[model samples]
Target: MDKKIKVGIVSYRNTRPLIYGLQHTALSNDIELIEDIPARLADKLKTGEIDLGLVPVAVIPQLGEYHIIGDYCIGTEGEVASVCLFSEVPLNEITRVYLDYQSRSSVALLQWLMRESWGIFPEIIQAEDESYREEIKGTTAGLVIGDRALEQRLISTYIYDLGAEWRAITGLPFVFAAWVSTKSLPASFVQRFNEANAAGIPRIDEIVAANPFPVYDLRKYYTLNLSYQLDERKRKGLELFLSYLKKDNEQPVEA
Candidate 1:
């Protein structure tokens, strides 16, 4: 019997459209799905626990060997409601940031934005628990993503959308995550996987129609905020973000 592909997936609302086709089609039988948060999924990919993953873009540089297989991604052209930084003070005044544990990409994006865009190196601390409120206090800002960010923005005094921030500085879209594999799989399998991802693009409407969000407009989130294509524009954005990441990584910490 042929071995089944082990695939890691993110269990977030923003990823629903990307996984819809895989879940609802005959392709489901060919792949064993492993659901996790973006950060955890990236770790699984690195350790070879899973053959393929919907990995955070920040984790790509650490993977040593990997291939981004699909033309679809978790991205946004501007003002992504789900990936943002909530602060009590203005951007320049924020000296401390509590990073979200659920995402590696958002944390890295925030770092890149601060180091390259904002030019202020704030003290970043990782959240010990899942509570967004508990992690942020006083002057410290909180980096929240996924469903929490959408809901948290309602009460936040200041919200900085990372996608919009990146666009403002670079005039390009931001790709948060993509389908990546650690090993060189068969070409036919890769094509089929891409086809599965493509199948999910049109089904976003169905996902929105079936599940209504009480906090925000789900249709608008899916249609306006999210950018699913991995076209030339998005690829350029990815490359630019990676460049900043390389620079950020090479910088030395203050004594």
Candidate 2:
């Protein structure tokens, strides 16, 4: 028998729509699904722990050569409520910030926003675990992501949505992640994969209702905040982000 293709995906609420019907379809027979945090997904893909992953866009530049397999992605048209920096004070007053260990793309986005957009330099501490969450007070802020970030919305005094910040920096939409593989996958499998992903978007209401989120409104999140299609403008945004990841773009970029 032929070996099943190993596929990795993020264990976050935002990723639901793109993978709605994957397990129920016959595609499940040919693919082995694995779930992990976004940062870990990047690591796994790099080490060949899995064949392909719905990983952060930040990892693409490091892969040397990678294939983005699907037509859909985890992106935001304007404000993304889930990926945020929570603080008690304003951006300028933040003396230190705890960067979440979940998604490297978010961490890089925060760094870029601080350097290019916000222009506030703070002591960046890598948060190894959820222990850093409680430390967010006074001048110390914490960057929380995924489902935990959604919960932070209620109590956090000041929330800086990085997606909104990116939208402000460039008028284009931001793609947080997409389906990427270390090597080119078969065209037939890729087509079926994307079809299963596409089947999920229109059934957003059904998906959310079936799996209710405790913290935030999943309905509004899927329809209003999150954008799935990797259209031309989002591709432009992705290209710009990859360019910024290069060492040369650090010296005062326009976009």
Candidate 3:
């Protein structure tokens, strides 16, 4: 029997297709999915707890010798309603901003947008607590990502989608997560993974139908808002994101 490649993936709504489709398909025999947060997955990937991961793009710079095998990614062309920044005051006037711990990419993107585009230097606050609404009451702004952000739509007065902000600033699509392997797996295995991912994209409607969220307009969200393919524009965004991490001032922990 072949050795199973342990794959750690976050239990987010975005990862649902990859998680379910892979498990139900032939790839299930060769790969094992370990549910974890993005940050924890980065650590697991570094420590060899998992062979491959669907990790945040920000964590890629830290991984010393990882190979991005697949051409698919969790990306967006316009407003990603899930990853948002809610501000009580105007963006330029904000003094302090709270960040979501679940995301590293959104955090870095926010910093880049705020510094380069907005010309603002608000103090960034990394809050452990999940209540962004409560945090925003005291702070000027709050950065929230994933399903929690989607649920708090009523409370948010001024919502700024990071993906939309990125497109507006760079005129390119943004990739949040990708399939990164620490070592070069066999060509057959890589092909299998790619095939599974490609197969999942077409069945996104079926996946979204299973979701508990009230008719999230999956067609609009998947077809119009998000881009599953890793094209040249997303590659440019990934390169730009890596550059931001490598800056002398930005001391990101090397993997």
Candidate 4:
């Protein structure tokens, strides 16, 4: 009997298709799914608790020897309503920005946008709650991603989509989460995973129909907010994101 490949994924609405597709397909018998938040998923990936994962692009830097296994990803081409910077004040005039603990990729992307494009230095605060608008007010902006970002649309005055911002800045689509593995799995296993993922993309509508988030239209969310292929644009975005993370890490720490 072959050992089942353990795969960890963040419990986000965007992952519905991948999870559902995997479970319904023949690949279900070959692999096991372990669901958790992005941060916890990253820890599991690093600790070898899981063999493969849908991990944030920013966390890739922390994983020592992981290799991207498949071409599918969680990404966007235009205004992704789910990853935004909500502020009472204009972004340029804001003095403080709160970070979402759920996403390292969004945090790093936001930092790059602030420093490189906005050219504003704001006090950065890390917040745990998805309802950051309640905890923060006045001249302060909150970074929210995943399901929380969609929820913020009703309450926020300004919604700056980070994925759209990244496209505008770099002329490439952004990939937030990717299918990654510690090393190359057996060629048969790789092919099986690919087939399962490819099979999932077309059934996105079915998966979304069964989703629990009644607030947003599941069909539109899958069609607009998520990109399943890791094409050239997304690959470039991944490279650029990794470069930014390396540069940020090399910077001298403030005394």
Better of 2 and 3 by TM-score: 2
Once fitted onto the true fold, the runs of candidate 1 whose alpha carbons sit more than 4 angstroms away are 135-137, 252-255
Alpha-carbon TM-score of each model against the true structure: 0.94, 0.96, 0.92, 0.94
Every candidate's lDDT:
0.86, 0.90, 0.81, 0.83
Cα lDDT tens digits for candidate 1, 172-194: 99999988998898988887888
Clashes of each: 0, 0, 0, 0
Best by TM-score: 2
TM-score, structure 3 vs. true: 0.92
User: Per-residue lDDT of 4-100 in model 2, one digit per residue for the tens?
Assistant: 9999989998888876767767788888889999999999999999998999999998897899887899999999999999999999999999999
The deviation in Å at residue 237 for candidate 1 is 0.8
Clashing residue pairs in candidate 2 (N, C-alpha, C atoms within 3 angstroms): none
lDDT of 4 at 65: 84
Off by over 4 Å in 3: 248-255
TM match of model 2 to true structure: 0.96
**Pairs with steric clashes in candidate 4:** none
